[model samples]
Target: MRHNRTQHRSRRGTRSITAASATVLAVVAATAAVQSNAFGTEEEPTAVSQSPTEAQAQDCGAGTFQAQVAKAGDTWKARHGDTVLYTGDDMFAAMNAGLDSLTPNRTTKERMVVLGSGTISASERLKLPSYTVLDVCGTINATGAVATDTGPIFSRDTTDVEVQHAKITGAPMYGMFFRSVSNLTLGQIDMRLSGGLGIRIDNGSKATPATNTRIDDVYVSGASSHAVETAGLDGVTIGTVTARDVGEAGLLLNTTTHAEVGTVDAQNVGTGTGYAAFRMANRNGRIGDGYENNIHVNQVIARGGGRGIFCVSESGGAVIDRVDIADTGNNAILVENCYNVTIAAEGGTVSGAGGIRIAARDEFANTSDVTLENLTVTDSFIKESPCAENTVIKNVELVNTTKDVC
Candidate 1:
């Protein structure tokens, strides 16, 4: 008899679970191996030999849980050993069914591995279950005619989910919107021509913010809004992100803590009233609450449209090591009412016509305790307003211009 997921969920106890358990479950699920079989024919489902690429894809992670999935007709089927656990029209449904069929225990681990490469044309949002790995080697395209303003994958309260090697296109709102998800990992994901934000990670109305989130090797292009936006996130790490042709900011972080980004390359960002390629602000209005702290950006390269880097609040300190800006439509760096911030460009190039602009918008606005060091601007580096009290500049070099030192 097939298991009903709704009944299983209803039977789940309300026992308190530790946050550490989510991390352990995610690691276990991510390392599972999966072997592929061929399907999608009028004949009965039969096992075909796995190809070299299929075997290599399964080896991406390491674990003991083993499962197989195949495209059978218009539906997808998931199996563990010989038992067919779930069959559905979309990958999310098949994955949820496979997870529901698993025996609930502390020692048991589960994973769903995609077999064939095809597109899942989703008309509605796909919500993922907790403590499971959705390894999609294919693409998911949203084809809804009505703009419902939803992401392809929208998770409200899920935990420990890892989505990898997938491409999402044509989402009406955000390509992937994760809310209140703990221990989430998105690796090698691509979003193209998204009508709204490319990716957004936020914990809405949750007591604990989203923690231990990692996004690596992501490429978002042609987004109508920000390419990657995050808020109410803690212990987040992003690496090798490339956002291009975005209508708004390339990457925006609000009320985020303990963030360490490796490299970001943003090109041709901002359409109307957009801020910058990278923006850091205090959206929660929790000043000095220690919820927004310790943001470190290693490398940044921005070209064409919008400001280069914008610090829009007096909260959330940041340390930027290197920046390369060119063809910026506004100031290369705009610091307004920010504190405890340091922007240092060591051995970097800034060829844009606009330079760093630091000022206060109103009486309450101020920029202080900021340090600019070791920067080489190819054009004039102008100061929009009077230098803030305690502002420091060191080893600055300007070429092909007379204005320097703000």
Candidate 2:
């Protein structure tokens, strides 16, 4: 194969390219391969087939241009195998288009790996092969654009896919999306600097948990929004979700199904510089639905936001346990309109405003069966305390003063 190089080219974001037409980019470090199948006009060619011009190689046939990239807007059709090394800006668009053009069938064996300094913006969505494992070991920048949600890595009706080891910055929308997907895994993925959350799941209302999907060793910083937002999902796992220096919440686990978080360290997030962490010891929509969903926050270190643990406008049942909120601007744990939610903060220090604001709503009439077990509130003063009615508390202390149920 021959090395190819070029400059500025774009078209929405989900265009395709032919194998014979794809440009083999020059590389500092990355490996690539190229191959294809053969068909015929009269009788079919054997194992291999030659393009009208030739293959994507240095030495073409008798009279043909070598494996140079076709002109801009040119596409390769039905090309399967590829080894592409991308460099320079706009590689995001280039690579996305190339992968889309491949258009493999529903077979779960297609694979893609991109390695380079990829920087770009987009106005469209890109689709990858089903049962595809697209590995990106490089850098990507797509910040500053409103979420056209214009996707570069999207897999619908796909399963068992994995994306790992990449620096993805400035997502116009979701860093990665899985719709109707199963057993998907995003490993060692880093999304930081500008735009929205590092990752998000549609488990609460819109989409399912993309079942058996686990995001591990993911670190996000400087988010225009949450470092990671998981909503309306079930059976999802976040290994080490860490976010700091962000806007909005650090990690928003709202209206979810079955979720298990390892270590969540969110600081300096929300509005501008606040630490509104999570609330409700349990953040799940319950066995009440007969699904028996479960959620747990193993270890949390939150600083400087509104409420450190917040579960507002959530229904169903959940359990939250063992959270630590220190030096926060607002409440340490607050739950509003939560039903059958049990919160446990035994080994924690809540030294901030509104330590635990679990209410039935703005009034006492709209209450649920909520419980705060083994919680400790130190240096806490009411940021509008006197937590409404019909709430149960055991082995808990409300220190530094407030109005009680009197």
Candidate 3:
């Protein structure tokens, strides 16, 4: 069905501030700016009393609108306040109408687009650009050949974006693709299945890396590629991510800086010939010059996969605190060409052909300051260290190890 597309634009004119009033206005403006930057719209507002200044700041602009799709109408009827904006069969048309009605004043006022629970089957990518908050609680399903052109939910060049309680299923490419975004938060993301990565965050060659990203409680199953892949991002934190039957690594970080993961559980990842449950890599087998650094994983549990955790090509400053592996196809943890790293399987058990292997492929490149501590290995073995002098082991119990430790 064909429909008319609507566009929303908030074009409130700005007024110049006088020098005499600038002092008083600056104080009030600073307080409002703090509220706007604190994920203010993402959370529910407080019920306590607010001062007049706070109230005015919170209501930054007037003429805000909200639209909801009709439940049983063939045409997607969207209404703003009490007026009907449009009635059309196109889901994007209705969504765009709602977004266009709001004036872009960057205020803490009520600016939103509430998606209907009905499944939206789009032939092309639905773009949400420059939206302060995108609370998608509905399902967006793709209906086309799998390609790298776009995704079910693609957002770019946005800031302070929040994606909450959303599901993107059966996308040809990435379920959700975000690029050049900052101060982003994603929670309760459910990607039932996707042809490519479940979620991908990258620079998209925009030269502006995505930064300050937070992902919580994400689950992906039957992903043809990595469940979550991030590259060229700074300051990312992930929590409670689980992937099942992924073709490549469940989570892959390439050229990322200052990343922290709370917990990740991958099952049957690395379905392809070369991959891992969790893979971290930098460029050119070097660090400290436009390379990835400062990655920490608190807990990792992998079952039946290629090396549970693989660090390659100058991935350094990494600290993995706890790891549990059972019958993985390859080494449970493999570190090649990495430095200043520490992996501790404290209070955990590893059962596989190879427990932990640290090697430097290039004879000239040396792996230094690597430590493995408090690990209990059973029916497995760690490879002889490539840099015997720099590898340190503490409180480790080995059973049936084929190679001797340094």
Best by lDDT: 1
Predictions in order: lDDT: 0.64, 0.51, 0.63
Local accuracy of candidate 2 as per-residue lDDT tens digits, 1-406: 1111111111211121111112212110111121111100111112234432122221111112111111122222222234443222356455654465443564533444443444566344446546555545445677445444454466665666655344677655666655656666665566766665556555333444446556655678876766776655555666666777777776776556555666678776674433365543233454333212255556667877666777655443455567777767766766665555556644555665545666545532243556666766777743323444446677766677453441
List model 3 lDDT by residue over 1-406, tens digit each: 1111111111110011122123333433443354333222222233335432233233221112243434234566666667777787776667667666655645443334444444455345656555444444355566567555477677788776655446677755788888888866665577778567788888777655677777765788888888998887876778767989888888888877667677789998885445777888763212344222256677888999676888887666666789888878878888887665677734566787857788877643556666788888889888856653367777888887665666
Location of the lowest summed lDDT over 10 successive residues in candidate 3:
8-17
Ranking by TM-score: 1, 3, 2
**Model 3 lDDT, residue 256, Cα:** 75
How many residue pairs collide in each prediction? 2, 32, 3
List TM-score per model, in order: 0.77, 0.68, 0.77
lDDT of 2 at 34: 16
Residue pairs of candidate 3 with colliding backbone atoms: 8-100, 8-101, 10-103
